[model samples]
Target: MKQMEDVITIEEKNHIDELTGLHNLTGILEHLRGHDKYSASEDTVIIYINVMNFKVFNQKYGFAGGNDFLRGMAHELKNIFPDELVARTGGDQFIVLGKSIDKEELLDKLDDFREAVHNYEKGLKMKIKAGIYRAKGTEEDPVIMVDRAKMACDDIIRVYDRDNNLYTEELDKRNELRQYVIDNFESAFKQRYFQVYYQKEIRAVTRKVCGYEALARWLDPTYGIISPAVFIEVLESVHLIHRLDIYMIDQVCSDLRDDIDSGYAVEPISVNLSRLDFELCDIMSEIDKCRAKYDIPKKLLHIEVTESAIASGADFLGKHIKKFRDAGYEVWMDDFGAGYSSFNNLKDYDFDVIKIDMGFLREFETNQKSRIILASIVNMAKELGIHTLAEGVETEEQYEFLLNIGCEKMQGYLFGKPKPVSEFVRSVDCSFENNEEFDFSSYYDDIGTVNFLNSTPLETKSMEIMIKLPIAIAELHGDQVSFVYANEAYIDFLKTIGAENLDRANEIGRSKERDNASGFANILKMAESSYNQRSEADLVANGYVINTKVRFLSRHGEKAAFALVSRNVTAQKEAHSADDYSAVLMHLLNLYNRIDLFNEEGTFENLFLCGNQKALSDIERKAVVAVQMYSDTHIMEADKERFKKFFDITTVHDRIESSGKHYLVDYYRSALPGDEDRILMYIILPFHYNGKWRFIAGCRYMDELDKLKSVLKQIEST
Candidate 1:
């Protein structure tokens, strides 16, 4: 009898985790099964707890320290929930089964567990995330219940600040998105939904397109173009991100090859390689294959090694980076100043260019401390003989700040957004190839004055003239000098001074045949009678002096007409007219060709007026137009409500205000009107105008906003 008792005790010992001295996986499963057999209460719940970044802890503290940490966690769990069945399910993961415990009670216990783990030991600190699933007697399988708990845990992991998550039907629905990605991963490659897009790095002072950064995009038939932010990590977790990286580089090579074939200038493009690529395959060989296959010039390809990637596999990354440099590829340290290992990695690695993380700009806009750090980084990089590339720039303020700090290369919405191969090719040719090299002798040198005046509509001709210069024009019909047409610049000026539908007002004034005509019409008739055939005047209005030129001529089979040209000269009044506001505005509008308005009421709208439409950009003008249509007519009430919530003006204002000076708010309009969707918009800091605050918003549909958001989340999590 004694021997048999000892044998039973030994058997029980086999069911326990050796390191934590808790119930093992088999033991916990059997225990739950036994409870089910005995008709356990429906209130029983399984709580799954996972240690965040356990691998990092293991790497830092070694296997023995990790085991100690797990042991301490198990001890804390046993003490906290004395009556519950606790088990060490796997490395840095534990399971707790309790009867008659509600969600709040489970959450409280998990919070205690998290706190205890954080204080466990000097080298054993960890953040634990818990997922809870209440059992429904024998209706649900114990294994499946545990899985549901794990799924909830996974969801909570995304929200770094939270430690506990309750399993719900909604979480299961989210799982569908994940499963869809996994199911369609292979097809995404085969169908060529994965595409290569490029965002050029431009010289800060010259505003010249100098280099291109290759980015990946997925065009899913069902979901449209899925953001890499949504799928990249999933692929990395499933060990498939390396394949995507290779595919992205290959696509970029193909595009470059096409550019060369089509006689477009082939600028060097930097391809980002996942850290897993180095771990899984021969990265150097893969790159060589791409260059050989495309017959790409050695200098035409650049290698961008991310700071985090370097931290993870320093030896491999350092070796490969040097090899890339040796092979004639310009190697860049991407996302500089983004992580804890930033300076350390910089000290260890050799790079041709240091791509300053856009987060600094976001931070600089919000935190005064970030500006000092940014300036320091720029100065240091220059001292080290490394060219600095500032990414995520969106506003004139940021562009000017970076240029002032001597940042060599600038890449962001301010310059241009990333574009697909077909569109990007045109953008590259237009921006960089308009001349032998970028001409910065004059900001408007590339913006040739519109001279193609032909059989075009008056409105079209007016727009062509307005966009190319600071001058506004009004075409008048008859001796009344009635407004038959008005350019956008003039319309904008009228709108600025509480004027609405000046064209309609002018048209009404033009109708002298009407019983009730505007007084302005009679005034225009008197002016026409008094003035010579051509007149010039310095008409001052609203703090701006307009150099007005009027000429009477008959053209395009029209009667004698008055052509009024008004050039704003407000910048001439300022001390620094060299940095003329109109010239600055033109440069900005030229760099990125989209206009957005954020009103005092916090209502933001896309105007879709920018540089020439011939200048290819990533901004989804179709989406902007669709949203504008909806805004105009209120077609989708639900969408309007959703947008109202997303674009909560008060919240945005508060956040921006907290930044002290101002920062760029990077976001995306993912669901748009047409099949092609997801436009990136950058909202600049607001300025107090009239009685309210208004913002000059811009768009860069490159998906870089998604990348920035992901980077910020990672920074917050760590």
Candidate 2:
């Protein structure tokens, strides 16, 4: 009998198979709900696994045997899938929601789960195979995720029915092998026993060096250089990915620092980040620490995270991407088009650069559709604020195709192979031959150093910056759209959105009173709004269909003088709206309020408040500092003590108020000796309104009571 405590609500309870305590359809439904929580700038991974021959197993072996087999498989999965959504999507099929677990971990767990199922001898003689596929992301529904995972799982299970790596009963041996790798990994890394190689990207025109991609090389001193394909699989099995990633980053960083400081131009180096690292620790902070230790700028360091890694049915990667970008480093998504939800990933993940896969480029020029796809990729990337770099660009045709489509930056064999630090420096620094015999060193005198640091005739660097700025377009009354001063990025954004592109139009604001559909609606709306009374207002226009942000900057708080800044977050905005916790909270607030039933008036008062005068003073000081971060002021530590000395213990830390309001204000201060100009700079308001955090922090600076009044009035007006 199910106990009273165990009888949970259907939604709250784990969707159980009832006969086996395994995942039911509810798991998939719930996993879909989680997809909405991720940031608008991230993709969610859904691996659908379909159970094979389940009906036959039940018919041949009977319900008891089938149930027993299910229980055994569920037990095996319980440990491996603690954080994942383990849903039995179909009769025997399962869909695992890979929260932030890497693909490698998922593979190993699936293999283990398969093995455990095969070992169920008490149940029946049966084979369990599954296919796994990820979501294509045309839709963000969890059902799509389940469908994809099921497909992918089905593919693997169909051919390798049983007695194979995909499905086996050798659980003990797998565990043993995993443990051995764990034991040896540390020693292998210590010995620097790894194979590190590099692939080069060449310039189709000059035949000069562009850049090289650093590939890891693991050489087992005892057994010879370990293959990355083999060792990486081993690392994944032991769950030591976080450590391995950190090791690679540290090594690359140290190597780059040594080479660059010694006067080598190793423009930038990229290291791959894994799911294990993100959950285990903040990789950005680690990078920050590394940069500080080596005296490196954050911008020089770049890290690559897989699309699948960031799109794991949660906003985990999106937030981390923002954090990394904020810390001043470029973030790139590796293997862009390999995944089905690649387009969704592109929109949601804020990648600084997109490295075009070489496979697409190899035969694109000959195929019309492939060429079109290549062109579209370039255009889309440009529109979305990302620079495009062609990867595996070995052929000159590929390089030419990229350049023709405005994809200038590239990395592959066309440039040069990745070499040791000493070798890379020599390769780029030395002279090279260009078309028909023009040496690169001699050409540099004609093409390089254009008065960058205040020289006379070559030209100014500032002008070069201006050239890159988008050409602005002015939106005036009907049939008068004209060109204005904007940048390339802005121009591309406008073009992508199908905003009418005008050539040779004037670049000035308020030219004949704005009259376009967008401008007219905005201006009229502003006229009808409260912001008309003030000088400025924030306008958040949600273009739901496009999933973009159109922000128009006006004069002051009012859309007066300056123009608007528009951005397309279509992939995220369209999909992200439903995931907003604040929006959800806003909807449920009234119901929650009815349930909580808090009183309007506060219960505490002066003297009875927690902590003594000294404690209150410390809190007040912190509040003052909290507000001071914004205030253009500095209260020296010595000055604080010096001021404290002026008041007696009681006078120094007594509470004050605006008068006649219970639970309204926190501790305040009166004029101190010899410092009458300084008034209380902080207040800890006990009574808070609405749902805002109470115990409010504040600041006040006044000379005299009347002066304070006048100053407050000025603040109120502002």
Candidate 3:
């Protein structure tokens, strides 16, 4: 009898867990396999318990404390079900097998376990999640049953506020799908089953393609099409997301190379990076390698990091983002308002663009709060000097709302859905006309600053003055005048005309009689002519004798955009014809040798020259050229540096800010042949409008102004 007892003790030692004095995984499997009550009975139940955030507890206490906690948990489980088979499977997880009981009774037992855990330390605040699986039939392998229970437990583990879950067939299906993705991910990646799709990012004001975002699509042979939502999470869990991210970068670079080699105009393409990408590899080095391999420009490839990613690991992500930006890649913050710490993230890191969360647009029509929040976000981003892009803009109403709120960029199905590169390239008009060089940065700046619905006034008094004026932004393509935006007064003017609404007015603008000698179309035609001349024009339309002033805004290919301001002048028109005075004033202005206009940022607004000087005529409409042209060409060698210093575009803003001055004046000696002894006056007058300042500068012989002053003095004496 003593010898037999020793044999039993030795056998039991192999089955027992050293730390908890409970059955280990191997012991549990062997016991279940031998016990017919569990292996063959359909009434048996398996419960898997996983301690959530045990690492926190383990770190708070030492490993020995973690062992003590586990042993205590095991003792509690045994006390709760003395007749059941209880085991400490592995690493803060335990398994219990027993005869099936009522689910409510089992839930009561779980509640008791939770209460006991909560009371165990009070300071620890650790929680345990359980997965319960009832046997459907005899299992060939007990390990499969254990895994199924663990899967169900995992479902609850990820979800806060949930302590217990029941195993279902769907869990099995999900497990199988996860396994499939893991098993075939490498094979599919090498076989070229993964393709990159491009979704266009549009300039909100111009409705032109500015860039694209690269999205991954899996064209699996067996699964046909696996949603990124399904596979991305699985890959992230398995730490394989870095491979997919690098693959996407390589694919995007390859496509861009193809486009460049084909002589197609390519825009910047942004590739998304997972947090795992940074942890698992040197993602920046990998991206640089791919870019160099394809010989792609750094500006053409952008990096997108999610707001949550930054919020999760801010210090780590901030370093990576700085590296990317230092390498000349623009890093954009994706899903701006999706998380609670959005403003915190913005404050903590630098991002070139913030993609407003799609949820705002999705609920735009139904929720009024969304509009308020979205508008606030756009305004805040603008004030911070960060660009804003609205995502999921899928309707005309949404697009119009975003535009009205001054969102700079947008992307969604309303513009174009994500599609394979082959299809996307076909849809876009890649053939760009080699038109005269234009300042696109200035154009985008103007677009971003304008919000007709809520325009920023130069002063409190100017708000009322601006409200009375009718303003609009019109895009002219041949004879068609598409109103991209119109103020309330402009829309009201459309009502005064035969057109009842803006849509009707645009239809009339697009009519066959657009070239008529009168009406809105005639005004558009006048604006078109003015755009060609690169000057503002006085336009007359039929209704109410309205006076319109149009100035060139921007141009792309054959399309030109104009900003128009109109007012009803019927009373003034009946009293006098202002056209005569305007013509006389235009001729008077032509007396100047050179005139140029630029915004506060030193972006050239307009350039006018009255003389046939080859050097002056050849000057480009750029800040540097406009500021230095006269000094370089016509000023005396001794005065050239002085003239440049006095007319420096860089110091203009600071001078204005410090002096509260509206104009700057400088006089220099001329270097031109036959005008060597002539003194020229360069005058710059700063004009404020629509919450911005523009400098209108003119250069003329000082003698002309002296002669006019003498004439005025003579007239006064008479």
Mind sharing the TM-score for model 3?
0.59
Best by TM-score: 3
TM-score of each: 0.55, 0.40, 0.59
Q: Kindly report which residue stretches of model 2 are placed more than 4 angstroms away from their true locations once superposed.
A: 1-183, 195-212, 362-367, 422-718
Instruction: Report lDDT (Cα) of residue 22, candidate 1.
Output: 75
Runs in model 1 lying further than 4 Å from the true structure: 1-14, 31-45, 52-65, 99-115, 118-120, 124-139, 154-171, 425-718
Q: Per-residue lDDT for 280-324 in model 1, tens only?
A: 888778878987899988777878878877877868778888887
lDDT of each: 0.64, 0.49, 0.74
Return the lDDT, model 1, position 592: 47
What's the lDDT of the predicted structure labeled candidate 1?
0.64
Q: In candidate 3, how many Å is residue 287 off?
A: 1.2
lDDT of 2: 0.49
lDDT: which candidate is best? 3
lDDT of 2 by residue, 422-536 (tens): 4544544432431112123222212111111111111122222112323222232332333323434556655544443433123211231121233333443343343432122
